[model samples]
Target: MLKELEKEWTENDRRDEVASQDRPVPWTLLASLAALPIAAGLFVGGFFWWRGRPARGALSEEIAGLSMVSPWVIGFMAFTAFPIFLSLALSFCRWSSLTTLDHAQFVGWDNFRSLFGKDTTFYHALKATALYALLTVPTGQLAALIAAMLLNRESKWIGIFRSIWYLPGVLAGVGMSVMWRWVFHHEHGLFKTLIDPMMPAGWHFPAVFEKDAETWGVPAFAFINLWTIGGTMMIYLAGLKGIPKDLYEAAEIDGALGWKRFRNVTLPMLSPVLFFNFIIAIIASFQVFTQAYVMTGGGPGHATRFYVVYLYNQAFDFHEIGYSSAMAWLLLLIILGLTLLVMKGTKRFVYYEALKA
Candidate 1:
């Protein structure tokens, strides 16, 4: 009986040992395994640090400068970088703002495909945006250049004129929208009122706000944008001021009259500024939202629907967060491509004073 009991006890011990061997590894062991590479990296980094101890003061100065700017770096990473990555991830997801992030399902290229293939509104918005940009950017730049030329003179009233021109830009947004709405009011508007007297007895101005809004919407916006030419005017004015007086004197001595002098001397010297303003205007025109949103609300049969307005409607109004993100990325790509094209095309024409020497 004692032998049989000992045999049973030995068999039970063996089973216990086998069970221990077969069991899954503990969390502690798994953590240690994961941290092995990290520990090695730290050791290697310490060795390098010790080897470079002679340059410690220079390193310390660099570190101090980095520390001074660390807050901005941290803020940019947290706010801008994180959001950009998150938005990019979400662009490939089937997500609605109505649901939580946990419910987001991975949807490969459906958002982009839908936009390019299925969505008719997307094409219409793109067309409208392109047309708007084409109309507004050049006209606005021309207006600004003219104003800059006029205001570049030295006079006591120059500041007042500058203030008057810039005031509209400063008071943009809702207030400007309201003013425009009043100005374009079909019957009672300042535009109609002023034009009424000049017209023949039977002739009347076309309804800019009513029947003509669909066809004339872009032109109307371009006109309104012309009012805020002050910002671009300032940039052009700065460029004009920077042009050397010697160039004008040389042109005059060479018998280059007003138009010739302006065409030859002024245009070449101002090419760089013009290129800068052109690029800025193009970008701003592509991303035009406020006036279209506030004034027309992308209305009158989607005639005034700009790209950003469409994106805004998709994200906020329609709750298509994923689709909106896709649109945003597409817009970014479009702008980037256009900017690169502009840069490449203008490489020969863009005058650099340093390069001339």
Candidate 2:
């Protein structure tokens, strides 16, 4: 009986093996796998042929070049262009990222109206940003120009001095801001330690990081920015180097001494670099964020509340994405208007060498 049972089990296993061998393979999957290489080959061949083909005109060459960049163009449209337009649309709608698109309500110009008419913080942020730009831009430029003039020599140690001066600008951003926070600390801070001893008995240094920041915030921030004048100084140095020595010779021959030669020759020659730096400084000053955010946290009764910090608070902290978008657009408009005004106002002063020639 045991032998007969074992024989039956063996027969059953043999029948299962035969059935597995007779089963059909999936032709659809096999065809798809086979077609992949053919499709790839055809695409590659077509691309090479198009590239190697002789173009009839400049337009044809341009079209071919554009075709090669079609992928980047598509990506930019999908990622950058779409988001920009969506943000602009959302600026007019009451929407939150937490909600579905279908739930977004049309609010037209309500966001803009509220910011202008109702929000005091918006105005305060604008004022603070304007104040920061006013204090930092001219002072920073002047300091950088002076440093550049002082270091504009062809000595062996000049490169070392340039590198030393440039170190601060290179060390800018969040890390620098955090360092400044410690430096400006109310008690046991670097500035306090240095200035406290110099004061008379019972006299104290100004509380730069405290309530007095309402009066001193912008200037303090400007002082911090002044530390990073290395970059601007390098630009000024380059401009100074480019000024023809012949101009100085001519001025000296005309009995122009001391400040007179500088006013006539160096100032006009460096005007283009000055204008470039001015525009960059203005834009950068308007967008000041890191130091104010890290050091003051927009504190001292919103005295250091920069426009960007306010925008960030609205978008993330308050979950007012629509309002933030409106603020961003407003800031863009302000920068654009200021840039245009500056360009128009300084057109006469900006002496272009090519134009003069």
Candidate 3:
């Protein structure tokens, strides 16, 4: 009986192996089936164009408009739209950069499950990213607004000051990262030299690249962020210039002075700009990668592994292209959700005069 059972199992394994050997994945057929909808869409579009064809004279300007913008539209379709849809499809399939697309084994929801299920690294990366965004966005905005307000004046040296402030922003990101690494060097960096002497005995400065760096790393990045407030400052300066002076005059008439005038007049008028900057800051902050990647490589044991950097490592370092693609899509969803939430929360506070109707 045992010999007969072993014989049956061996036969079943042989049959399964032969079945797999006899058939290969029909990627060509799959591709054709996948393209059928796109082909149908193009056909419908062509039909509509022919059916709704108007006199050339009526559409000359329209044609001219489309012709003028055709380059951008074409570029967007090729570079942006195509890759977006490709990534969406790839997210569901297990493929590596080293392998052909045809070799991608479809494993729907598995990548997402892994990310959410037992992947502690994913959670850590998410936490680091969220914390960095929270710490940097508001602080950077406040610093930028203050600098803008101080510089919003007519003077011979005002432009010089503006240029000086903006210079840091235009510097190469990797170069800046390298520079900051040295500035935060564990023992001999500028920070240690400047901050160590003031400390009491037995107290140590939080060396951002070394011991207990996790506690101080994100904050150090936030401090580095303050130095690159030039872009935000320019935007705030533009918003300040746009505010009607009469509003300030009215505030003065109403006995609203100093901070009261700013709160009542400046803030309401500038709310739209603030809203815009807030949205932009959130988007940019969540995608923070270069500085962390260059400085730490998400290390001292994944302490500073930010979202994008983690995604990057999954793709290139671990060869988990499918997982990384899922991570990218998840990030898109998160950003979109946050943006919508902020818009909903701030709608009443944002002073869109035209929208008041």
Candidate 4:
């Protein structure tokens, strides 16, 4: 009886030991594992739900959308908005690398007075830039229009000719400048060869390399701009292609031909396209820097001193960051004002058939 009791106790002890070895997991750890993915899912769902919520005002919607694109908004604020405001502030104060923020004194409109009232170079640069624009815009647009008309003709191998004309415009800037430099080379230049023989005795061509060439005020840069208009011509060509052939045929049937057909049908039809191209061309021409920089370096007595180039010199060369900032703002305002003026003027001229009564 004692042996049987002892055997029963041993079996019971063995069963309890085995049960303890296979222990159940802790409730805390099990709950944590279950909650992890559920918590993650809830967070993800809440983020998307917050993004698509309705807003109270237009500005609120804008802000919400901007929040969704917060990275870009942050970037714009840091890079563009902050810089502009800082510039405006800087323009009103005198600063230097050695000077701390406390050292910057309020100068009021002294900088503006210097730029407009005292600095003769500012007016000269403005005039040069304006002249460049006036010469380039009208001539380039006319040339492009003429080239487009010629290309629009339904003839064999016209595509080949169009491509040939546009090749110069597509050439790399350095390569184009180098090529143009050769073409305008005074001693062995093509223009020299063509024009020198036509002149009377004791007269040489107006040399851009020579001193006092600015006073001559010739259109040497104008021709360079004209040569670059090949690209613009191609864009105009594309615009011309969109005009229906039926319209031209209908005009021809109504006794429209030559200049009359062009004036009545082509011009009216192409007015919208012309307006768009005109604005683009004007904006581009006003920002003309590469050719002048590469070729002239604002030399020949600062004849080709473009606004952007001057601004660049002020910012980087002279370290007049504040002054440069002011110039940039001025440029922005001028461009904005001009664009608005052009749009207003174009309203009376540009015709759209879709919008017509």
lDDT of 1 at 45: 87
Kindly indicate the candidate among 1 and 3 with the higher lDDT.
3
lDDT, candidate 2, equals 0.80
Q: All models: lDDT?
A: 0.79, 0.80, 0.82, 0.69
- The local lDDT score (0 to 100) that residue 221 gets in candidate 2 is 96
Report the alpha-carbon TM-score of model 1 versus the true structure.
0.82
Q: What is the C-alpha lDDT profile of model 4 across 70-163, one tens digit per residue?
A: 8987899689876776677666554443545554545556566656765565667788888878887898899988988788878789989887
Off by over 4 Å in 1: 1-56, 197-204, 354-357
Error in Å for residue 244 of model 3: 0.8
Kindly list the per-residue Cα lDDT of model 1 for residues 166-277, writing each as its tens digit. Answer: 8888888888888898898888999889998999999777666567867777778888998888889998998898888888899889999789998998888899999989
Instruction: Indicate the TM-score of model 4.
Output: 0.75
**Model 2 C-alpha lDDT per residue in residues 1-357, reported as the tens digit of each score:** 223423442343211122223323333554577568768987998898778866589658867798999999989978987677667766776655576655555666777887787667778999999999999999999999999999998899989989999999998988999898888888878988999999999987777879578887778999999899999999999899888788889998999988998888889889999999999999999999888888877876677889998887767765667678888888888999999999999999989982243
Top lDDT prediction, candidate number: 3
Q: What are the TM-scores, per candidate, against the unseen true structure?
A: 0.82, 0.80, 0.89, 0.75
Note each model's CA RMSD in angstroms: 16.8, 19.3, 8.3, 25.7
Using TM-score, give the best candidate's number: 3
lDDT of 3 by residue, 1-357 (tens): 223423442353211122223333455776688689879998998899768867888678767887899999999988998889778877876766787767777666867886787567788889888999999999999999999999999999999999999999999499999999999998889988999999999886778877776788777888899888899899999989888778778888899998998888888888988999999999999998899899988876667888998888778775767778999999999999999999999999998981232
